[model samples]
Target: MKELRADIERAGLDTLSGRKAPRARVLLIAGRPGSGRSALAGELVRQVADRYPDGVLRARLSEPDGTRVPVGRAARELLDALEAPAPAGAAEDELGEALRTALADRRVLLLLDDAADAEQVDALLPDNPDCLAVVVSAGPLTGIADVRPCTLGGLDTKSAVEVLSRFTGSVRVTVDPRAAERLAEQCQGQPAALVLAGGWLAARPKAAVADLAGQLNADLGQGTVVGRVLRLVHASLPASAARTLRLLSLAPAGLVDPHTAAALAGCSVESARATLDDFVAHGLLHPVGGSSSPQYEVPCCLHPLLSALARDHERPAELQLARARMLERTVRLLQSCRAITETDSLRAREKLLEMPRSLRFPGPRAAADWLRVRRPALLASARLAVADGELDTLARRLMSQLVRAMVAHFGTRAAASDLYDVHGLVLDVAERRNLPRERAAALLNLGDLDARTGRTADALGRYRTALDAGREANDPYATGRAMESVGGAHLELGDYDRAADWFGRALTERLARGEGEDAARLYGRIGAAHTYAGRYGEALRNWRAAVAGHRRNGDVAAQARALSELARVQEYAGRLDESLRTCQEAVEWAGRAEDTRLQAALHLRLADSFQHLGDPASAALHRGTAERMLAEEALEEDSEPEHGANACEIRSSSAEE
Candidate 1:
């Protein structure tokens, strides 16, 4: 035991002053393991020994199992301290009276260590003013009504370092003060870790405390003090709370809404909420920022502990089940976010019908806020599923919904990064399942999103991967989609030849299948790439073929797209009459298709066409229509066919469309 020489000397005041000067009636010393609780109590006993003529009394009221020590046993010890003989079968009430009567007019001192509870100490407390009582326990005896209590946690930094210095020797701790401080912090202010860590470093006194802290941190897994602490805390929790805490540790964003918590825990919201506060009281979590709705985040200090606990305690099947629940909840939220945004979408209406009544978030804004805050956690969860192995399918499904939600809300930077991560995971899942069609689909989506976000190189890589996957499956539709994405990426990268080659390949396959919308889209893309390369005649021909195919297939958005490309080609060809005619036809097609942005652009083109045709009044009228439509977006908002394509800029007012 480390001598308590310093603290012992300071405890001198315990004996010198009595009740005549408002004496120290209670000397409550409490601390964690190896923190001198016994030593401090011993020194205080020595200071007050002279006044207590009846002599000192000591009682231990704890079992290793934490079951409370019986009050009768404690009473017996107290009676013995009073030199009162009691029969072995004495009842607790009789012993308590005998102890109180014995100390009624005498000065006495009591030291009760590792006490079990209030009742154990109640019988030992001296009743007279001439007595001093000391109590020590791991927790504050909150159930105790009368006696003042002192509960111990950990030593403060200075005292803790001082305690460590006793072992490491003064020179080392004094030499590098800052490293010593960080060592204390890494110990998590726990005296046991500090002492163990100090002993670890002190054995090799030449070693830096910082170096030891680093090495110890690197090795802080199942065998570490931190690990044991989690095991104990986890084992100490109720079965239900322990399960919930494990599942919640897997939450990506740290903060969770009550519904998500319920979904993750497989419990009612009220139950999950109660569990949440229980953790908070134990200093395991803290409140998260923002309150578009209120949220609570698990503290970082507790995260590693929770993680270790989950890894150690949760069986694979149990953890997988928990993950499934959280993902199911995520998919529901993603669908909800989409549904609440699009007023006329039948899919949206149907999704809403399927939503659980307890699917919370008071309003659309509230839901958005929740998503914003929990975004990191959700994304991290997706990553974790893939990393956990055998969870490929779950990860794929999770990423699909996650990408949709990310696209609908959040910035390009965040969404693009998320898209890349999900797409990467999707490949692994597809490979494992031997689902080439699904692989192609995943790659195509990732590539398309990448191209839209201006990540041309990344887009090309994904597109080529999709092409390979499609060829392996011998799936013509998947292959055609892959080619189209590759063409788009090449066009963005200024590789006109490569773009045209891929587009032609996609077009031939689509034609063989007699899929006109598929054909129209490829033809329009080829036309655009040709136009970008200044190949006017080829662009015009491809655009005309695209327009004819789109019109025959009743593909309104495709028709408008082809018309816009053809008009641009005609305008660039320096044929004023042909350009004017094409621009007017483009406007007619856009109007027919209810393509707002295309219509607006066509109006502006018409203004240019009229100016070239020497009609100033007509040009002015077209210009106003174009400007008004561009500003209001009334045509687009009211348009029945607002397609998901990169043809127009979508301005998300929030993370929602």
Candidate 2:
């Protein structure tokens, strides 16, 4: 704390805006794991916590294995700690507002420990300048503004000796002070290593400290000080305890609750809990606070040792078996989670129900809670499983199930980027296995995601690949979808002529397959492209054909949609009376379809047509009706964007069909 204080004073103050102000309200303490960064941050908070009357709040922002805690999850934790009520499934930005609002009037000391990066800290910063945030992280957290950085190295020899004496007896250190100093030197001044050495000595009260030091020097010839001390600590444990410790390296996110530990160790949850508690007591693992279950994690410095030990002692088959169990358990949990969110889709619900239920969640809430906590680990597992080609087909199947579940819970747009990596993995597998149908499906999905994110060029490229794969697989449905996507991408890029050509090709295919409804939708897409290109004659013909097809298919809503597009083309062609008549009939169709939003938007279009015909009173009446309907209920209006002040509007809503 004293050293940090000196650095803080050196950082000085800021005088921006012609006024003196403290340089930073946030302090960053960066160090390696097991270097006592958390302890240092805690001490700093203790020294100045009383300065902020609202109280101090500390949050762990990453798992031990270094997966960043999702921003939404982190915000939820902060709001919960602040006693602020947050709506369920709130977005990350919404949760951020809730956190900032809760902290707005309070002068608080916030300690964000084990932060993965600066973004995590930035999202959780309070709006109030009176609040202070002390962020602890392994990284330097560069490029963040107004941060006072305190980098922690190993402890000094004096502090190290005191730590050892506190853990061991002072008399033991007093008897052979030189040997004690040598032991601290061997520890490389790391507090964790020193404590482990102390615990080793404390466990054996009569053992000579000098002899143990010599033994370590002889046994661990070229190893790091941390590695040497960890070996000694791990070696002293019982066989079962040591085995459990090694298997814990397989634990997801390096976080081990009782149930997870039991799966890894093939034991009962109660027994695993007791074993973890014993490790906590002996300082082999640190107990995580603010968690519902009694959880413990091996220190990061010691984690590598556990991994190496597991690889050396555990058989390959044993490791694989354990991993499979964890994956299977995760798959079952995701199935339940995806099932609960699929209330509207019967096909998706049936798929979820057909999945084997080796594990069961008590309710939907429990299922959602588990998925929220374990999403990172589940994704990590999916990537690893896909990369490991020798694994069973169950791994790939699990990945598919997980992707479906996440997309069901979060909308496609919200979850697109999160699922992109997994989609890439699936594509790789399909290409490697020479499965043309799967490859086409994967490419189509990726192209759709790219289009949604505004990557028009990339989307077009992927769609081309999908089209070729679909043709190779002799799948007409895939081919039609790919063609449509390519046309949509062209439309997004403002290449309306090319878009119209591709939509024509797709429409031909749908008509040949007797898909009348889809053919109607494709015709509407073609009409939109022509309208965008200022080709009113071609646009009018395609839209008329679209309306006839929709009427033949008995689709009242779709006929209303097609008629709305036809009205815009008619208005563009200097036929105000015809346009006004088409819009009126379109409004009647929308009413029959019970689509209030579409009805209101058509009324507005009617008003536009009337005004163009030089009739102010009729225009005003239609405009008033549209406004009244829009205000009565929450609805989204779809209408053409008006071209050059008096020209016709070009509606592209049919492109979504």
Candidate 3:
């Protein structure tokens, strides 16, 4: 690899080391599509990674289909790689600022690969002179200052021959050195072409090097060397392998696992695995991921060729069918992925048992590992399905399962950014199909994420729109949810009167639907909103209602919480004796609920109320009890085994129900 671009590597390293600019040193590795610029940049990163003690970060600025990835999305990807918090629904400029701030003090290496233009790279460049950004683009970054483009071309003949030998072996190249050189020349020393040619030779072991060279020379047409070589290799594949190769184009983002391949090709997992391995052997596919569960990536240079093959050989209907089948299979996998975490649920276990062994994850850890590894491709699958505009049912199923699986494994907060995007896709499908119920659902989800990320105004807009859609669909559940969400958004924005009104509306809906628990939650929300607005009388009434509702539902913990709120409202109303009585009642309920934390908190409240009522002895006694309760709870927590902690803890939204 060093022999292939030793000079370029040396020059890049020198430039990065010598620079002390106001911003990151920018190095542009410009090349044609198949000239191995990405590979060379990767090699340079490997060579100089130690210089940057912070870390190395990479992001692809363009998708496999040449679509320019949005700058905000790219920045989010980089932040995720850094394990930094990136707010959902942030503008591109904000995300860019965040990215720069993240790298401002750190000596890091940023590999901005396959960038579309100067602006794309500039948006992501850090302001730290100690950092370096090596950008791989198809052409010069015209607008950037103080940077020179290192243009890459085909490899030199000697290095090309070495690359070839790694695939075809040395014996063939050594026995017929002239033919090997001719074959390398025919490939024009392009690494992509060389690999394909080498694979072709490797496949036909008995055939002389001259034979493939003659075939390529005869087949030279109005196309790229890589294209011609890909055609030749593809043409030589056995029927099953050829079909698998063509179907691989359907894999999202050119990322394929055996299960996806199996689904697309309508074959068994074992058969698909064998065909994939064969493609790897012939350089038609590149092995990625770990050896434990191997995945493959189709080379971007070959995407067009494979796509053309699929278009020519496969019917449109057949292609659509294949896509639908792939999505359905993905849904099932996601189901199993989430179900594996429900260890206590017999229904989940039954679902897992019904699935094929290959589709089921061994346990929650393995499921999470698989989800992490496949996140990019799985997201791509959802995006592509939505963009297809013809598979709304399958797309909806795929997205629903995707969201649940992410929440099950990564929790909502950790996965909020991705969830935001998926919810947008869901909205797109809902709008296109004119499905008001689904639209309302999607909007509510997006609003929840927006609220979590502190975009309360945006969340308010979404929730209001969702409310309209729910009303149009006459879905009481959705309508109630939208009302509560809007109220939560209003509460966050400090519009407490409007928040209370909306929460009251949601409470009415819940009551009419006989949802006692939800009604109790909404009553608490209304009470909180009233308290925030300094309406103590209204707050006390709502809190009393909340307490009564929870009692009717036999929810002792909720009743205890409601009663504690009532005590605070009573104190706000200057009813000190009433506050004391409410606190004592809350403490009793907390004890009955077996919620030690709540019990301790209520005792503290009781102590404050006793002190306010001028009862020193009772105040001192309750304070002592509260402290003892807390201390015992702490000891119990310390004694618990470390592994008992659930890694897949789902975080609830901070927004009131």
**Which candidate should be chosen as best, given TM-score against the real structure?**
3
lDDT of each: 0.69, 0.77, 0.87
Query: Comparing 2 and 3 by TM-score, which wins?
Result: 3
Model 2 spans with C-alpha error above 4 angstroms: 11-33, 37-189, 194-241, 257-259, 268-298, 344-358, 362-365, 392-395, 635-657
* Residue 19 alpha-carbon offset, candidate 2, angstroms: 16
**Ranking 1 against 2 by TM-score, winner:** 2
TM-score of each: 0.59, 0.72, 0.93
Question: Local error of candidate 3 at 134, Å?
Answer: 1.0
Tally clashes: model 2.
0
Where does candidate 3 clash, by residue pair? none
Cand. 2 TM to true fold: 0.72
Per-candidate Cα RMSD to the true structure, in Å, reads 25.0, 8.2, 4.4
Measured by TM-score, how close is model 1 to the native structure? 0.59
**For candidate 2, lDDT tens digit of each residue in 1-657?**
886766445433454455544323778898877788888888988988878898888777976656678887778767766767465445689888889889888889899989998888888888776777889988777767767678888888788889888767888888988888888888888877787787778767887779667867776666667778878777888887778888888776666767667777887767888888877755677886653435666676677678888898899899888777777666776777877776788985777667644344556666666665666567767766776675636566777887887776655554565566577777887887787888898888887777666667888999999999999999999999999999999999999989999999999999998999999989989999999899999999999999999999999988987898898788878887888889999999989988666787888787776776787788789888888887774445455333221122322232321
TM-score, candidate 3, is: 0.93
The digit string of per-residue lDDT tens for model 1 on 93-154 reads 87677777777777777888767666676666766756777777665665543334444556
